[model samples]
Target: MAFNNARIDAVPTLCASCEGRKKGICSALDCEQLVELAKASRKSTAESGATLLGETEGIDRYANILSGVVKLTKTLPDGRQQIVGLQFALDFLGRPYCSESPLNAEAATEVVLCSFTREAFERMMQESPALERRLYRQALDELDEARDWMVTLGRKTATEKIASLLLLFARHAEPPEKTGRHFARFELPLSRADMADFLGLTIETVSRQLTRLRNEKIITIENNRLVIVSDLRRLKARAGNS
Candidate 1:
């Protein structure tokens, strides 16, 4: 688990002030464990489009997302790329105990990461069953989500696919607040091209479906990336979810 790359030492006070401390993988640690983890960790940020790890690259560390989004992508031999998954706030990054990344991880939005040296993180996980268990649970949940998305891509219609994508973003976004009559607002982290890549649809089709939803008064797009859901139930119905 040792990485030859330069390691950055984290400030203990920085870990104490992290917003994701309660929700991230570090949440499994006790106070003493947190101090130890903090000593081995560093805080870093990635701007949109920055690659955190390239496909098949050596992994030096693992990280917890404190804010923003990251996209995991795989490219075919011919250079076609597909976004395999998206990670949001409090999600763990890097394959624990593994030396290489199977896919590329890139920042989809400005991102904050709390990173730990691979050797340090693996040692901590080995000594802490709770931490290991929490990571295992997260892996299972991500596997389930991947399977569900497989169904969405293979079986759903264009409209259903678009609705499903919107629902996915809505669930991860800030809790819905009543703005006007029956409306709730959230910002979309993915661009239209990113959405299309994830959904296996053409950009035109994605745009068309979004337009259809807007015309139906189901959702409203503002400032390009902001979305306002007019009715949660209606949007879910269009997603083909009961």
Candidate 2:
């Protein structure tokens, strides 16, 4: 998919996420300290599908997204992949102190990242208790999200998976106005292939399920971009407790 580089470059100024700011994870720091840390950050961009780091690869740096999306995927020797997590704007990647990564991180869409050398970042964290605390919180939050995904993948049916995923988008999604209970729209962050991998289903199965949802009047898709779901409660019912 094509992305506008000019638009992406314009995004950081508009970013509301902490990582986009000078203090970043050190949001609790004094102005002087934040100013020092911000000076060390460098910006870089990656195209969709670019492999940032593969599983088992060494990580010399850690980064925070400035724009777009990234996916962290784990694969088996038999050629199956399961998307473990997604890194959106303001999200950090490449844990410090880890020599090798367990998952491969790739650009799910064109992306920009603000990078810092791992050693330098670790040093800063060591000196900054507030930063360390924030990182710990971030780790715990990710763990919770992982457990949630596991529940969906292991117990939810195809219809349920779609519902749960859409509900997730709704939680983070920003619409111009609260649409009536019947309908809402948002762009999908990942392609059908990535969605299939994340949900532990075949691409064909994903396509069929999407079609079935539309047939049931649950959702509508247009231009490979927007998804409009009518009756979110029905979607939730389809998701059930799983």
Give the winner by TM-score: 1
Clashing pairs in 2: none
What lDDT is obtained when candidate 1 is compared to the true structure?
Answer: 0.87
lDDT per residue for candidate 2 within 1-242, as digits (tens), equals 24433233222322334455653454555554444455566778899999998899998888877777789988899988778888776677886788998789999889898787787788788888888888888788889988988889888888888778777765555454767854567788888887887788888988888888888887888997788877777777777753
TM-score of each: 0.90, 0.81
* Winning candidate number (lDDT): 1
Give stretches of model 2 more than 4 Å off: 1-19, 22-26, 78-80, 177-184, 230-234
Model 2 TM: 0.81
lDDT per residue as tens, model 1, 1-242: 34355443443586667766677788787766676777788898899999999999999989999889899999999999989999998999999867899999999999999898898889999999999999999999999999999899999999999999898887777665545544567788888899999999999999999999999989999998889896788999999998
Model 1: how far is 152 from its true place, Å? 0.5
Give the distance in Å from residue 104's predicted Cα in candidate 1 to where it truly belongs: 0.1
